[model samples]
Target chain A: MQKVVRMDDMNGVASGFPKTAGAQAVVEITDLSLVYQTADHPVTALANVNLTINKGDFVSFIGPSGCGKTTLMRVVADLEHPTAGTALVNGGSPEQARRDRAYGYVFQAPTLYPWRSVARNVMLPLEIMGLPKADQRERARAALELVGLTGFERKYPWQLSGGMQQRVSIARALSFDPDLLLMDEPFGALDEITRDRLNDELLSLWKKTHKTVIFVTHSISEAVYLSTKIVIMSARPGRIIDIIDSPLPRDRSAETRDSQAFLDVAHRVRQGLLAGHGKDD
Target chain B: MARMIRPPAILTRALPLLFVLAVLAVAWLGGAVWLNAPQIIDRWQRDGKTDYSTGELVTAAWSQERPLLPAPQQIYADLAKSFSGRLDSPRNLLFHTWVTGSAMASGFGLGVLLGGILALGIVHVRTLEKSLMPWVIASQTVPILAIAPMIVVVLGNIGLTGLLPKAVIAMYLCFFPITIGLVKGLRSPDPLQLDLMRTYSASPIQLFWKLRWPAAMPFLFTSLKVAISIALVGAIVGELPTGAQAGLGARLLAGSYYGQTIQIWSALVVSAVLGMGLVGLIGLVERITLRYQAVPKAAGGRG
Candidate 1:
């Protein structure tokens, strides 16, 4: 099922043409590497990783577990520091970008405070940003409405379904209206049906907001369906094995998964993953 | 199949508690009889009464003046007498309760303040966690009974008599639990949540007020329940060493000196009820403050 598309040569850099002609680069990484100094030995999480994500791009970092996909995203978010090289977010250092509130991060779990109501939880980032009280409420309302959680404002996190809770977290991430969104397997914990529904919703939300999203996931079909550019990585001194620029149309729906182009991209992703594992042996 | 009629929820919850209390009351009655019997038998022999039946002896045992162990009813009667008088009078149990309760309230307030500050320091500063935590634990290890008298004597020598000295003793006993609990509570937010806060570029003060403080509420209430009970104990003990007038501890001392077992039991019972009331009050406040947290199970009905 795999198509014979030319793969970008692995020269420690994967640069794709911006979809929109004058789009500026949102994230730029240059030979970035991170080594965790454990008690026994140093564990290499990311090695000589170089990539550029442009504005309005839905980039998915897909790999096996312990492949530094999440670690790479964390490095870009300034949640973790690289031991070597550098990462620039919005043309500034990741730390500076973070201090300017350039991005919002959604963890695998919802991480909503149990004590706060749905609206209040969404307002949390805005509150910390020192937005006016009325502005916080208005923005939270709009964010919740964007995620189709309009009537559930007063409900607590525990009262919502797992899928609904994840949506609320998405709304929370969008509440501050940051230019970048770093999502670490936000729907990884949901069932397959819920995951599929959320994938469609996320695509529409991305189209509406035009935000640059760096999503980390282990699922090949998900990465193929949602992302414009897919970064495939390998473990054991984690590094990118292949970068594929998807040829799928901009607008996607549930029926898009059955198209030949979708299957072709997915098959190439599977091949890239196998190639990464083959190096491990 | 016939439908079974389930009991009301309140009654179902109360049944086990009622059973336990009934068993305790029966055991207490039996203990009173057993302890008072020997003394009553000696009294009968000294009075030269030869034909007293077992039934009469049992009744006499329960009713004797200055009995070794007062019957539950005698203590109840004493409590009734204390309550029937003017509430502000020295003879009233309420008067003594007020004295002890005031000291407990002040001490609990002081303990909460000190504990909150210490917890904030420990959570923020690594040095405080390493250097001061051991000392906080060591302070609790010194028995309150041993130190209460000294605190009272020292504070009294400096002219800080009355409720303040007793409150200091109470504060000393209560602060440890609150400090430990608040520390755990303040740090209760998971790493992911803290990282989320960092992504927002939240300042330390903002993080504390918005995230850490709210997260610590449930833990604070739990520790307060424990702290308040111990504070009452500290206040009562503080009263004992000083022979202070007008407190429950003083009433206990007077009862013991005069061989008034009923009076002693009455004071003990009042103190026990007061402790329960304090804990119950804290629980009520917790329910109100944490109403959003009631549905622990995701499947439960919404608030």
Candidate 2:
């Protein structure tokens, strides 16, 4: 198994990423834990988590529903604070990084304002960043075209299908050209066909932009297919159970799903998930 | 074929209302005859004309000098007579309508502005929402009719007469609905939308003008529709207790003093028409404001 996992150019190294000099590791989390105080009892969403995500990596967090995958993403996005330990983005606090517009977030839902046109929705972050109107228009148009929504620029979110809405949202997240993109179950609400198509497009998008993407999802296949590194988590005081770095080649087609290496990785992920469920049972 | 045969959208909306109006006209004419017939017969009997027939009785009732319930035609005729006169003449309905309409318009504008500001504060400040919202709700529960006289007297004591007092009343009545609707509207953005804004490092001001306020447009306009109609009512009500010698309320009072039921009915109808116009004006503004929000229907656009 170790022989099967070939560490290519050492760029895909997870834990030792930051310690290596001059590496462009975008996120560094060390023993980070978050305890949410509910009305009745305190719930631990994440416990003793450590991970390093390099620039241009497609990282996926896969776990059960109550697991802290989304929580971890939220922490990195500066939407939530940790209960203990240090988490940094671009060598600074998440709060400072957020203020610097270091990342774009795509929620589980499309989350586009129904009142805004698609171009206007994509221009939202740009507008907030005080980009001039002409620049906003140009960047927004380019992002929409990248997501295959060029002609739908003037259409409202409600006018688009669910899959199309998600694509528009992706366009919105990319419009400002943030270095890091955080997505929490973005394709969770989509149909299998749409999700599959988006997954392919998202890969292409990642290739073109070379942006670091931290994706949270429940689908094992989705996590395995898209991720260079897959972090498996468990619920009830959620913690990272395993981190499987993909040994698959850089250029992967749909037929890659049937490859022995792909099956081996998927089988390992399934085992990790089953091992997680076994603890609860 | 289907496209050519289909009716205009406006006509489709107007048809039901036109049918209702036709039914109402028939009812109003029938009711006027039924209600005033006996009074007509009694007056004729007093005049030694006891041999009057039912048709004559109805005609006389419809054409009465002072009817119990004025016939619709009489009111229309009175409106025509008043409206056709000089604009400045007291006899002209437009003269009095202008007086009331101006006060209502001023009040509506002020109410919307104040309501929008209050909603902004309430949405931004959780403490204000927790404290001030209950009072706003409580303020509306107090009946306007019961409070109108008191408000009039107090404002009069301060030497604030004429349009100011009426406009204040309009402001009072109109603000609550706008505030409530706006508060709900300004916060209408889903958690995800709000989170997205936060990710962009959007300032509170940007969050409002860009995201929250735009989302609240539909709610704000809906509340304005309710507010404008009531603001007009408020201006008219302000006229009543103050006993001003102008406006629709003043017209009603003068007609009542002379026992001219037709005049009173005409004044009431005129005021209703004015209310519709005010509401229609607001609706037009709302359409212009939200025009850009209309879904693009290009052939290639996704459904």
Candidate 3:
């Protein structure tokens, strides 16, 4: 696996930051487990999950439905609480990190306020953070441009295509310039062609911004294409089965997916998923 | 090739309503003649006039001094007379409308304020939603007609006479829909959207003003349309128990006492017109407020 030296890690290492400070890691999970108390019985959503996501790493959690891939991301976002062990974001508790606005979260749906225009939608978090009007407008403009939605600022969400709306949501998540991004199946609702295009766009965006991302998806190809690290999870008391660090170069294009190394990593991922399913069967 | 000419949108929209009105007018004229003919025939028979044509009987029925059901022309003439006089004159239907309309307006204002407060309380506080919502629902079940007189008498005893009592009754009727609509509206945002707001670390007030309030605009307007019409009804009902000298309710009372059915019909027409005007006003405001919403279908109902 080719290890890329990120800017934050270089700064941490140069500054002699202690390993106990979790300087290089954007997220650290240790034996994390979550149980949902249902009417009939307690359902374990996550089981003894251990993972570390480093700075500027594009991490994808790939698993089937009912898997705790989304749940583990939720724990990092403080949207869900773990029943056992710890999940940390930016060297602090998830709740504290959330309050500090350390991350931007993109949900399954666009979740744009229909009342607000595209620009205003992007500016929402900025507004909540009490950014000045001029600063908000400037940041919103820059963010919209980043997602290739510069001219669509005045248009409403409904006016846009499904793919465009998802892009706008990505712009919104980026508007605040959070150190980390959490995306939960953002392009799952889009058509296949749109999904492929967005996947490429997402990779380029990740490269340009160098922000750590924790993406949850069910598509193995998407996971293999976009991620530097792939976390495979299992269902019915979901747990991590494998973590594959990609050997692909730091820069990749559409042609990269056809390469032998890409297929090898994808094959390993498929095998891991089948192995997880075999345990349940 | 000749281009096909289509009716303007306004005309097309109004055509159905115009057709319905024409049908109603024809039915109303026929009903008037049918209802008044018997009285005319009885009078002619009592006078020992054996030679009477059906056409003459119909003409006499249409022109009766005190017909059971006044003709449309009679009501129109009465309305024209009331409108021609000074607006402040007690005999003018506009004056009565003004008195009732003002009371209704004041009550509607108060109702909106009270409803907004109650909805805010109920939406933000779980205990208020559980404890107060049932009482709020139960409050509406008690018939307004049965309680109007007592309200008037009780308030009169406390030196809150005339407009205040009537306004209170109007407020009582109008507030229920607003509260219910607003409560539903405030809670209408998708759970995912709420989670998005949580991610932003938005305060409770921000969650309301930025998301919930805007989402609830459609519901609030729909409720207002219902509330305004009912507020007018409340104002009239409030007037009935008091027997005060001014207002549509009083006009109906006086007309009945004098057996002037034309006057009664005219007052009823005025009240109907007033209700339409109020609802139309609300529709106008709703359009202006919710212009950003994508489609009218999106705001179709409480959903």
Candidate 4:
């Protein structure tokens, strides 16, 4: 099952591939399939997946619980491997890209080390990169400040609320300033109000940094609100069913969420998700 | 809200003190009845003209007419006698026997350090954990009494006398609790926390020191409390096998041999006091260390 979508399918889909339109792709995945060999049996997770993500696109993977969206995100982060696939990041293997610090991964939960304060947690990647002490400190503070966590440097993880902790995790992700930010349900656990606030903050951050983002979420509203392109995946043996181009404007604000265009795109994404459900059956 | 709730100064401030006083009163009353204070006092009056004086009651306990137990007054007097060196002038009881204390101190220190290092290794290396965890559990199964003589004899033959015999014994007893508590502590990091550290790209050493080690503090203190008491037991046990001179263990031995029940009882009290002090010290350090980690705006921010 080598399902592939040509470039025509992604036309005007907000990939912004013009930076190196003629050059080699940043991430090129083909014929990706995954199966985990459990004691009971091999569980087929993903099958016949093919996609190309350019350097600075805001892409959202929207699917149900068993759709393998997170698995795909993990695969891209080099945290998990597909059973059969040709997956590459930045013209290199996923592991090589991970080693070269080309991607920053944010998990569903804000897995901040409770013992380390916010700033220290952010400085961790910098330390691994062997950056100087002063540079680590400056970059950490800058990242924290960018996430609106400026005065919380010395605060431990437990000291913050769930939203604050997630913000800290985002700050830590941004600390290294990687080209690709792989987020797996980063705001899925938060309340609706906090999620909306974080969405705005994320869009502003994304606009400023222009880093490639691959976000996995089960929330339709979140995908519609945040993504330039939304990839809807079918459940069980997950594969992309539809890649919807959101017609909402890029200069988003609170009022933009209430706009008719935003609701129309959200409705379209929901329809795509419903179509995916039919495909699964 | 003002009428329903009392002032913080009046309520929160005085509540704990009142609670503590109530608990102490209950304990004192219970102890008085359980000890049969009136009967003990009558016996003391009756035996007031006997060999042991009223002062001896403080350090050495008495059993009225019986010899099974010493009275509280008798034990108190013995404490004075032991410290005053009046029993045998030149060779004072507590002073000449300070060796036992040094032995216990050295043994406890060595045990804590060794146990701490071993815990780190076991927590990190799965193979070491599989091999060593069983032996740790097995070590506790061997009765200290059954092994004490063998250890003493072996050390004596190797010309390793003095604190070595006792320190080894203390370490044997102390390490198990430390290892068990520390393993749990090191493993206490939530999955979310571990993922965070991984995301930060923290090295193994950094992870241990910054995350696992600090997280293990409360557990460490709990085990240290148990281990310190066991260390004292080990020190005393070390004294028993050799029939050594100086130390509370030796004091217990000598007292039992001469049927000086008061002497043995007083030495036991001293050991208990020492053990309590060590546990208290660990608790104090725990409080200080945990204070810095405490979330200030948390419900109970009194740390």
Judged by TM-score, which candidate is best?
A: 1
lDDT of 2 by residue, A21-47 (tens): 555768877778999999999999999
lDDT of 4 by residue, A72-173 (tens): 887887777899977878877887887778888888888776657889989878887789999999999999999999999987888789999999989989
Residue-level lDDT for A221 in candidate 4: 82
Q: What is the DockQ of each candidate?
A: 0.75, 0.58, 0.60, 0.47
Give the CAPRI class of candidate 4: acceptable
Task: Provide TM-scores for the models.
Answer: 0.95, 0.92, 0.93, 0.84
Q: Which ten-residue region of model 2 chain A has the weakest summed lDDT?
A: A1-10
- TM-score of candidate 1 against the unseen true structure: 0.95
Model 1 regions more than 4 Å off: A1-21, B1-10, B296-303
- Per-model lDDT: 0.90, 0.87, 0.90, 0.80
lDDT of 3 by residue, A218-274 (tens): 999999999988899999989888888777887989899999999999999999899
> TM-score order of candidates, best first?
1, 3, 2, 4
Candidate 2 ranges beyond 4 A from true positions: A1-23, B1-15, B292-303
TM-score attained by chain A of model 1: 0.93
What's the true lDDT of residue B89 in model 2?
A: 97
lDDT sort, best first: 1, 3, 2, 4
Worst 10 residues of 3 chain A by lDDT: A1-10
Lowest lDDT sum, 10 consecutive residues, model 4 chain B, at B58-67
Residue A115 CA displacement from its true place in model 3, Å: 0.9
